[model samples]
Target chain A: DTAVSQTPKYLVTQMGNDKSIKCEQNLGHDTMYWYKQDSKKFLKIMFSYNNKELIINETVPNRFSPKSPDKAHLNLHINSLELGDSAVYFCASSPKIVGVQYFGPGTRLTVT
Target chain B: AQSVTQPDIHITVSEGASLELRCNYSYGATPYLFWYVQSPGQGLQLLLKYFSGDTLVQGIKGFEAEFKRSQSSFNLRKPSVHWSDAAEYFCAVGARLNRDDKIIFGKGTRLHILP
Candidate 1:
């Protein structure tokens, strides 16, 4: 059983297009996060949600938004996507008591 | 802000050789440090974490990490290297907040194993 899973393992779109990546965790975790791994393989936090509430929002552009409907799900929506948006996105979940997070397989987004 | 740093960008080790990956963090208080490994086209997998108590913590796959408060470092080490161990390793610092917690990760160290 996969603890964390993300939809659209790969995404390819043109500039100015809008897309959404869905994430779900079956680990019964209270906190979920979204991360972006750039071409240089640098992983950076984008957003974090606890119990469906936005908690940590990094210095990301407004074009990128994360929405969590519940504790088990978090979705990322990007608007006006540009070529620079090309990267791998990973979703992770962790329990409140223990901060250890389990990550999803990741979604590779390529914007041309 | 809390952050983790990986000094080495890449490292090469021969099979059966010992290996160590360096990691450092900056925080005001005792930080929750972790080491995560990422195989090609796979998600990051937790190797070990240092929350409290003993400085040395053992993890899966014969991996271990020692947390040094004075140095503010958590270095991952293995007795012997396996070709299958080649992967990207990330060091992270988990910061607890009033409402939620967040983990800041390092750029990552790529390990290459030789036959």
Candidate 2:
């Protein structure tokens, strides 16, 4: 079984369009994270949620919001997408102790 | 703030050859280090991690890493390279200062294995 899973493996939308990516983890982990990998392959932590509480919010724009309904699910919603927002978005989960993180197949977002 | 650096952006190795990928980090206290691998069209996979105790840590797929506190480096090494090993490798650092102390990742090093 997939430990972590994300829906819509590929998303292509026009500028100003809003889209959401869903992530779920079956590992019974209490922490979930969203990371963005740009064209330069620079991976940056965008947000982190632990036990349904917002733990970390990076320097991402306000258009990006992360919602965690429960410990098992975390979703990312992006509004007014721009060309620069085109990149791969990854969802990962780890235990509360911050050990090895299990990641889901990334969702490639292309905003034209 | 903790950050990771992967000096080599790209590396090419022949199959059956030994491989070493360098990683460095800057932090005030002992940091939790990790090495992750990402294949094409896939999410990142944890190769190994070093939190404490012995400096040398072993990971899956015949991968290992040595942590050098003096040098503030954690380098991933493989005895023999395989064509399937070609992928992007990322080094990350985790801090304990905050509950949400997320893992900071390096830009990543792309490995190209020649058969």
Candidate 3:
């Protein structure tokens, strides 16, 4: 079984459209994170949640929001998506904060 | 603030040749270092990590990394390179006292293997 998984591997939407990506981990971790990888392949942290509590919030725009209903799931929702929002979004989870993390297949968002 | 630097944007090595990827990090205290590999359109896979006890740590797929506190460097090396080893390598650093538990990642170095 996959340790971590994400839905909608690819998404293409027009400007101003809203989209969401779902992530789940079967590792029973206490922390989960979301990261964005630009076309240059530069990865940046977007948000992190620990036990359903928000922890790290980077300089990402407000259009992106992460929701964690439980420790095993973290979902990202993008509102009014712009061309700049198009990138690969990755979901990761770790046993705790500041340790090895497990990543899921990324969701590629294409904005037109 | 903690940061990771992977000076090389891309590196090319012949198959069966030895390979080394340099990584340098800046942190106030002892840092948790990690090396991850990401294949095209795939997710990141942990190559190795160095927390404590050992300066040299072995990882999956015949990969290894050495951590040098004096130089603030944790470089990944392989005795031999294979075609499947071609991928993006990222070095990350995590501060032990960091409350938010965020790991700073390098821009990533793309590895190319020549046939």
Summing lDDT over every window of 10 consecutive residues in candidate 3 chain B, give the lowest-scoring window: B93-102
Per-residue accuracy of model 3 over A6-101 as CA lDDT, tens digit each? 998999999999999999999999999999999999999999999999999999899998999999999999999999998999999999898898
How many residue pairs clash per model? Answer: 0, 0, 0
Best by lDDT: 3
The residue-by-residue lDDT of candidate 1 on A1-112, one tens digit each, is 8899999999999999999999999999988999999999899889989889888898999999999988999999999999999999999998872399899999999998
Interface RMSD, per-candidate values to 1 decimal: 2.0, 1.3, 0.9
What is chain B's TM-score across the candidates, in the order shown? 0.97, 0.98, 0.97
For candidate 1, the TM-score is 0.97
Residues B1-115, model 1: lDDT tens digits: 7878899999999999999999999999998899999999999999998889999999999999999999999999999999999999999998675564577889999999999
Which candidate's DockQ is highest? 3
Tens digits of per-residue lDDT, candidate 3, B7-106, equal: 9999999999999999999988888999999999899999999999889999999999999989999999999999999999999999767568689999
How many clashes in candidate 3?
0
User: For residues B7-100, what per-residue lDDT tens digits would candidate 2 score against the true structure?
Assistant: 9999999999999999999999999999999998889999998989999999999999999999999999999999999999999998877776
lDDT of 3: 0.95
What TM-score would each prediction reach against the true structure?
A: 0.97, 0.97, 0.98
lDDT of candidate 1 at residue A108, scale 0 to 100: 100
The DockQ values of the predictions, listed in order, are 0.67, 0.77, 0.87
How does residue B109 of candidate 1 score in lDDT? Answer: 97
